[model samples]
Target: MASSRRRPPVEAPIAALRDALARIDANGPVLVAFSGGLDSTVLLHAAADVLGAGEAGSEVESRRSLLAIHVDHGLQAPSADWARHCVGQSDTLGVDCRVVRLEGAPQRGESVESWAREARYAAFAGIAEEVGAAALLTAHHADDQIETFLLRLVRGAGLDGLVSIEPDTMRGGLRVLRPFLGLPRSALERWARSRGLAWIEDPSNRDERLLRNAVRRQLVPVLDRVLPALRQRLPQTLAALREERDRLRELDRRRLETVTEPSRSAPGRAAALSLCAWRRLPAASRAGVLRQWLALHGARMPSRARLAEMLRQLDAPAADGLEIRHDGFVLRRYRGQAMLLPAAERSCEGAASGFCLPLRWVGERRVEVPELAGVLTIERIGQVERVEPVGPVKPVGSPGRPGLAERWLQAPDLELRARSGGERLRMHPGGPHRSLKKLYQERGVPSWARRALPVLWAHGRPVWAAGIGCDADCIVSKGVRYALDWQPLRRSRPASAPERSQH
Candidate 1:
């Protein structure tokens, strides 16, 4: 009778909005890719509200500064009408509106949906660049994340893919933030409806033919009928799964640090990972480790078949130049090392190990290209043709680039030579196989050099790898684009004529 109890404070969408604003670690003049869809329109409204609350300015000025962009995908039947509706809405809301038209022939053999989504993001990225925005925020609600995670699980993806979407990521050096990952789609609908906000309905969304729509309309409702509490439990279940994924990611991180190279050659990138270390781990651990390694270097994780092949390669001794390919790339090993250079770095030198050629434009001084070391030109060549070397060709064992012989070959064959004793072979298998390039150097070869000189036929095509330990036989032309030629510089030495040099 004497005690009075206080009621709990009410939770609101405004509170949710404020929390999202607070989580943004950096201050922003952020540019939202506002599509005027329910999610984006809500986000635009929320952002404007937050900006005005924080900054010292009039409401009109603050709201006017909020960038509301509407994209006309030109796919749906009434897209222009929808664009006009969005413009009118933005005007009513006192936000600046801009319409962007995305034009491209929908790629054949791909879903228009997929193409459209990619186009939308590309357009957003372009605008973000123009506006100099640090981050682009999207309203990918909890339901979207759940659907994505379920899709990945059904697709038999590893945890990296199963992790679905994250709260944030740095994309193309631009930050992309998804704040509503914890809020349900129903919550967004309810919030909008409460404010008398109407959303444009895309007819494609209702198409039962789409897998996601079938999942939403049939599979999910059936599941909900069977277990009414499934929706409530999903968020927690996702959290638990993510926690498990985090632990796995940490384990993968440790393995990557131990096995991956700090610096690697085009070939060494693959070989840097030790087969012994790979085999020692459990199967699950192997997959986890490989996933982490691929992600680190901006490569997509290999599929189960490809991962199995890599394991097979690990089982094979380092000596065999094993190759495993997936996702349009060929991963090959040489001299107990693996290289991922595109199939084009393979090419013969312009001349022999120590050929002397005069740069005609620069006058009579001879430009010396070392036989085994990298290209060393005392005089520059301005008029030589360009050969974009592909495949396993690399400037191995140089001071700046060890175990990375085939990395970013700059100024290719511009009066190159087999310069003596100063070279090193950034060998495959082993990170830096010692002195392979140095051997050519010690022998007093030319100004620039390669560790192993392949069999270059009369036409100057490299028909073989270095023939010492590795071969350029596997490194050849590409399938899609035109194969690159060995850039300019005429060979002065005969095919079999060996320059007098001894290591």
Candidate 2:
């Protein structure tokens, strides 16, 4: 049996910090995320004490050099002054400091805290990249982690969100180190006092209206009194959850790799998935796979409810036109595969594809069609050259067939129009003409994607439809030739097609 005597409070936070630093084992200069607050003031001082004053040069001394970065969100009236104060404090510790002033006001519907955090992290990433720093240090302590955990819990977050904050993690290509995560806020305050450190307090911290502040003030005090062991217990729970989350993520990664098909047009994009295999997965596994797929494409994780809805839609019949739109991406199910496309691309679907606009191709290399949300490129090809079709569209002619004929390419002014209706294209020379709708159907082009496809017309006659390629009449001949290529552009536009261009 162990003795039950209470231990005295630690004299300094330096020991814990040094232990944290040792665990990090970074052999490069570190940038401290200084905010002129008690927590960060203590972090900056301890870092300065351990690392020494000036920049460290040798590999052995690299961990000893420290730099401070202060991001002025300018949301509060005293934000500018706070930045200055941070600079002054850094100077007192003989540490190099940089101050970044953010510009522009938060957009409507955007919260101040969210905007500030985004701006702050972006600034830190930029500075870290510029200085080639290996790590960016923040002063998030145990109390802050508890507050975050509580906030996430109230919001019905899952394991990932519950353990979102970690002591060390990579962000924006740099290691984000939270050395004081194991220490309490009171310990940091005591350390600051012992070192005669002075720091400014942000007035916004006292605002209970903010969720974080409410948790920190009202919820934390109550928890401290009723369940004093929560602080210690929560961290242990988070650590266990983190390990479990990582193990699950690794499993999800392997599953995702087996089912994912890479996009040809967009690098780093997930183009399609095996519907059969996806449907066989358990509901939770399906959701995990979807989350991993979206993350691979650089999309934010949707809420649990939203993810459930997405999975339901993905499992629905193909005729249902199952496409679920989320904050940054759209889960599109077509034919027998699943695709995660940018939300902007969702507008290109449906009845909007019927709207038509015509543009003159004046021998330029590229033409930007804002209405279609894509660009068309005109490139000359040799007689023997064969141009493959883009995306789902198949090649127009037989194997080894050339692209658009040189004569057609030289047409004084060729018209590039959108499919309106009742359009006919001769897919083979001397062959019967077929409706554009039938051709699109035969090519497996999604109905929503047809409107965005460019149709090249020569003398009021349909010569080629992007994706389907040049018509039989426009096949490349034995002379100078060119191929018209269409590439989609990413932009924020209405689902409805733009009004007819005056040109």
Candidate 3:
């Protein structure tokens, strides 16, 4: 059992809240993540004091308004009670409050702590978006930061992990502020007691089975007694680590931009890395670049051994369809380019290849092909001045693929489907038909991506391919024309998953 005595209260917590709120770039509604714990109770109180009672239209006078989001993960039986307590506390303070109850528990083989944290933040993000919040405040204090550092250190974390908690940072597009990072937990407890505030003690905090609980209970105290100055020194050390981390991150971003490009398969949703350019980087820089690239696609950081293995594989021959799976994503190397794709995309392509999507060419602007995970856009390019059957179509604009003649495109029987074997396109009138396999090989399209590239068919013959130009037979020397372009949906990623903390 832990002692219940509280230290003398100080004015530091309120000052810290004011400073933190002032630093945010935007001015709008702010949300306090209230957990009904001593740290959060103090944070909520301080927030209400600084930002006012958060009535409707309060933002008109005060730059920002306040509200409380109490996420009930429901991991314990008393979670509902804790939520009620948070609402009661918020109401007493005259702050608007909402209780979000999280559904489901940790899946098999998943960490309860990780699941809880991810689900909790996900819920917060949803509410913040709904309320148009500029920032979300958490009650992470100096002690929590110290605990984080020690946990990461003992777990063999790298510099990114060792940076511990950041005072201001973006998570899942939400600005998360930790005003209490500079204040000790004891200060919060003292403030709560001084004001006679009430809070809940999470029963799971006593469960040493959780690594964080064990560290806080066993290791933090031992370190505190052994080195009385550790708390002060550790924060300085962490701040320096964070500075170095930011510096390296900037350097890595510059280097990454040179080697990477928008994914030709799923632009905006995924990225493509040029293997040749990436290989030219120094060994140390390569790891950083790879880590950053994986992050853009929502992949958690790979272990040192795992990252090393990925590098080793990249050094090998550029094998089309080479895949390395990690955290619900598949990193694939195809056609001298490395791509990060959602695991589902890789697994389901085989089945999707055999299905034919039949549709009419009714002058529609876009056709959504869910099975192919992309959209087929047919844009009218106006009248074709002249068709050079012996040569490729003249460039009308960017993405200048040859246009399909509107007269020929109006045929009743037209379908869009994945590539089947032996498909060929006649590049020019009276020219020898070329196999799609050979054409894809010439264009450097990877075998894996070929299955999903939607092919437009008319009168039982392929008229146009998504990434490739249309058949010359489908073009007219005169009259209206429509260009074919396929845009694949952004590679899907898990919307809510533990990030930065666990894989």
Best by lDDT: 3
For each candidate, C-alpha RMSD in Å? 14.0, 8.9, 6.1
lDDT of 1 by residue, 267-294 (tens): 2224356555556677667777766665
Can you tell me which runs of candidate 1 are displaced by over 4 Å?
1-12, 53-66, 69-74, 77-88, 91-119, 122-130, 169-173, 262-271, 318-329, 342-503
Those runs of model 2 whose alpha carbons end farther than 4 Å from true positions after fitting are 1-32, 44-60, 63-69, 87-111, 123-135, 170-175, 209-211, 218-233, 257-269, 317-319, 348-371, 375-417, 421-435, 455-465, 470-487, 490-503
Cα lDDT over the full model 1: 0.52
**1-503 in candidate 3: lDDT tens per residue?**
98899955538987798788877778679999999888998899888877766334332325477889998887789888898898888888788889988899888977878788878888888888888889899999998998898888889999888888888877766788899999888888888898788889988789898888898989889988999899888888977887788789779989999999766544335669988888889987988988888877667777789899888888787566578898777878766778877666666688776879778777789887777777777888877677555565332235544578886577777888788788898876888889888877766667777787777788888988767778888876677778777765654323342233210
Candidate achieving higher lDDT, 1 or 3: 3
Q: Write the per-residue lDDT of candidate 2 for residues 399-481, one digit (tens) a residue.
A: 45467775665565567777778988776557778888897777566666666677877766777777767776666546666
In lDDT terms, how accurate is model 3?
0.78
Q: Candidates 1 and 3: which is better by TM-score?
A: 3
lDDT of each: 0.52, 0.72, 0.78
Instruction: Estimate TM-scores for all models.
Output: 0.61, 0.72, 0.86
**Local error of candidate 1 at residue 425 (angstroms):** 15
Best by TM-score: 3
